[model samples]
Target: MISVRVNGQRFQVRAASIVIHDGHVLLHRAADDDYWSLPGGRVEIGEAASATVVREMKEELGEAVTCGPLVHVVENFFDIKGEPNHEIGFYFQVALSEGSPLVDKARSYSGLESDLRLMFQWHALLDLGSIDLRPAFLRNTLSTIPLVFSHVVHPGADDV
Candidate 1:
């Protein structure tokens, strides 16, 4: 959870999960926020990106996940609470561990993480264009997901 300051802005390294099932994708938004995005958190020092996804899932979803191959590598520059922020994100394809009820249900559900009060939900993949997913690039990329991993660069967020 280290934050580095670069030219008065903040930079971070994060890992995200792209969990899809039955034509839907799993997304989460903080309780006070208005947009949806992948579920994951910052990568801890010394932790592998893949492991970060696994740990974040357990913390945010209260479920175990098995991370598959990395699908997208993104360099995102955005602003949070008026502060410029940048993140190097690793998006990995993931799934609920075997026997998890979520795997069987494959429908939208909401829950508040006890500590953060973050709300996790499932959204139909077909409707992603209407949602506000940060890094913005994802809005288009998710529809025709590439079989091979891709590199993405989001110059910056317009909200700044």
Candidate 2:
């Protein structure tokens, strides 16, 4: 991972998935945080964005996904705990086939990975706007998915 630090905060490259099933999307948020985001993680060295999404799905959801085309490329700039943070997120259209455990499980799941306990949740598209979905542009994009790959630039906190 090639991370740059600005005033003690790290900027990173991440990969996320737009896993929509039955009018709902799979979103993950840490138990300690109040915001929700896509189910993906940082991009490792030499790993393609699609591969990262697939790997993340397996690790986070315990299910396999067929990564589809690139949907959106988001340039997200925001502050975490008052520290400037930026991330380039590649969002792919990932599909979960029938019989996937995530498709029929409880709404909340907890797991211990990389020394952090993470929580994952599924939210209906209709309820997205009521929550704090990071990158802020994500909520709007989800409502009207773009036909072609588009870039979303969120400049600092005001943009959300």
**Residue range 1-160, candidate 1, lDDT tens digits:** 7469889899999999998877777888888899888988888899999999999888766788999999999888778888898889999999888777775445555555555677677777788888898767777777775435889878744533
Residue-by-residue lDDT tens digits, candidate 2, 1-160? 6468977777999999898877778788877888998888888889998999898878866778899999988888778888887788899989886777777535677654477678877888878899999877777778665435888788645655
Q: State, as a TM-score between 0 and 1, how close model 2 is to the true structure.
A: 0.88
Give every collision pair in model 2.
none
RMSD of each: 2.7, 2.4
Question: What is candidate 1's local distance difference test score?
Answer: 0.81
Clashing pairs for model 1 are none
True-structure lDDT of candidate 2: 0.80
The candidate scoring highest on TM-score is 2
